[model samples]
Target: MHPPAHGADTPLFIVLNAASGRRDTDAVRTAIESACNAAGRRCRIFLVDGPGKLQPFAREAVERARAGGGVVVAAGGDGTINAVAQATLGSGCAFGVLPQGTFNYFSRTHGIPAETEAALQVLLTEPPRAVQVGLVNDKVFLVNASLGLYARLLEERETFKRDYGRSRITALGAAVVTMLRGGHRSWRLRLAWRGQERDLRTRSLFVGNNALQLHQVGIADADAPEEGQLAAIAVKPGRWWSLPGLLVQGALGRLGHADDILSFPFASMTVKPAASGQRRIKVATDGELNWLAMPLLFRVAPEPLWLIKPAVAPELEAARE
Candidate 1:
C-alpha cells in the first residue's frame, strides 16, 4: 500500500463534540491529551459545545490541517463525524475518526477501535485510505441519508434516546413506538436515474453509502457503496404498514427477501417531490436533521474520505461486524 499520507510526527486537529455519545468529555479529553503527549505529536482539541458550533469548529480544524499538514479528526458520533467530514471532504487534507458513538458503524466498518487509546494510536500512525461518501444535495453523509417517514423516525429516535438512554434496544423501541403511533405519509416522487425517469409513491426513502451498513441490514447489492455507487431502499406506496415487517427482517439480516420493498443501486439519482411549490424538505443525514431544498439529488460524492484505518480483507469484516 502507498505510504500513509501523514506520519507519526504530523499534528492532529481533533474536533470533539461534547454532546455526542455517552462518554465523559473530561475523561476523553484527558485520554487524548495523554496519548498525544506520549507520542510527541502536536494535538489540538477544539470543543464543540453546541450544535451551532460544530461547523465553525470543523472549518477551523480544516484550516489548521491545511496549514500544518495535520490530520483533522472527529471525536464523536456519526453526527459529529458528518459535521467534520463536511469541512474536510475536498480540502486536500486527510481525515480521521475517534468513534465514540453508539453505533460507530463508519469507524467500526473501517476497523477503527472503540477504545480511546487504540483509536488515537491509529490516528497517530495509520495511513489514509479512500472511503465512499453519499450526498443529498449539498450535504455530506458518511453512512446513510433518509427522508419522509424515516427522517421523522430519526427525529423521534433522538427524543426517545434522551429519555430512554442510548442503546440498540432503545433505537428498536423507538422504531416500534413510531410505527405503532401510525404517522405514515406517502409522497409521489419522480425519480430520474441512469437516464430513465419513473414516478413512484413511497412513505420513506433511504440511501446507503456504507457497504457494511447495507450488508448488515440485508440489502442486496451491498457492495454498491464500495464500487462507487449507492444503494437505496424505499417503502412502497400504500404499503407503509409493511415497514414493521421490513424492520423485523432487517433485524434478522434478511430484509432484502421481503416483498413490497423497493431496492436498487445507482450512481446518481434525482428525486422530485411532486408537490406544488414545495422546494424545502426535511432530510436526515447521518442522523442529523436539516431542511434541504427539494429535487434532492442523491449521488456518490466526487471525493472520498481519507480515513485513517486498518486494512483487512472483505471477508474478514465479520469480526468487525
Candidate 2:
C-alpha cells in the first residue's frame, strides 16, 4: 500500500511510550517538538503509560489523521509499535516509529535508526514498508513470540526488573547465574502445523517471523521477525550442558544437530498438552508473559503491518545486499 503524500497540510500524531528508556519524557517531547516544527508538520504528542492506553487513543488518533490523511507514529519499543499497528490496521494511517526502548529488536532488524535525531528525520522523510506480522494465539506480534529458555529469560529479567529497577548488569548477571545453576526445564511439546502433528520433548521453542541476526554469530534462519510466517525452533534437553551447543548451533543456523531441537514453518498450529490436562509450558509474546494455556494455538495474519525503518548498520546492509 502506498503512503499518503506529505502535502503541505498533513497532520501528524506522535505517540511516545512514556515509561520507556532512560531519558526523561521531557527530553523526548523537546526532540519531537523540534523535529515536527522543523518539518513544518502540525503534530500532537501523547505519552502512553502502557500498551492498553494505545487502543482507545489509537482510534481517535487514526480518525484525526484520517480527517487530514496524516500519519501516526508509535514512538517506543516493539510492544508500542504492535499496539499501534493493531489499532490502525487497514485504517490507511501510516505507522511510524521513534525506537526508544531496550532491545528494539524489531527496529534493529528492520534498520530503524538508533539515534533520536536520525529516527525523527526518517519519520518525516522516509516511506514505510508494508511488512508481515505474526500472531500468537489470536494476538498480533510485530516480532516473534517465544517459549522455552528465552521465555524463561524474560521471566527472570522481569522479576529482576521489579526488584532492581532494570539494572542491566544485574539482569545479565542473573541470566548467567540462572543458566549456570542448570535450572532449565524440559517439556513435552505437541505441535500441530497445518495437518501434521508431532509430540516431542524440548527445553525451548522459539517461534519467529524473521531470523535473528547477531554481530558475532552471523545469521540464523529465524522466520523474519516481522514476516507473516511462524518459524518454530525447538531444543530438547536431555541434559543441561546440551543447551550451550544448541544455542550456538541455533545462532549459526545449524538447528539440525539436536534431535530435540526442531525448526519448522507453519501457517497455524494448536499446541496441547502431551498428556491431557497438564500445563507443561509457559508462553511469552513480545517478551511478556501471556497466561499459560495448554495447546497454544498460533497463526499468521496474511496482511502486512506497515513500519518505518531506519537505515541498517553498514555490515548488515552489505550482507543483505
Worst 10 residues of 1 by lDDT: 312-321
Quote the lDDT for 168 in model 2: 54
Error of 1 at 76 (Å): 0.2
- Looking at model 2, residue 289 earns an lDDT score of 70
**Cα RMSD, model 1:** 2.1
Q: Write the per-residue lDDT of candidate 2 for residues 39-148, one digit (tens) a residue.
A: 88889987777657766776777788777778888887666777777777677767787887766766766766767888788778766667667777667666667787
Error of 1 at 164 (Å): 1.8
For model 1, the local distance difference test gives: 0.87
Model number with the top lDDT = 1
Q: For residues 1-321, write the lDDT of model 1, one tens digit per residue.
A: 232358878999999999888899999999999999999999999998876899999999999999999899999999999999999988888899999889888887788888898888888777998888889997999999998888998999999999999888899899988877776888788899999988889888899887778888788878888789999898886555667887898888788887767899999999996666878889999999999988899999877778888886343267225
Return the TM-score for each candidate structure.
0.95, 0.83
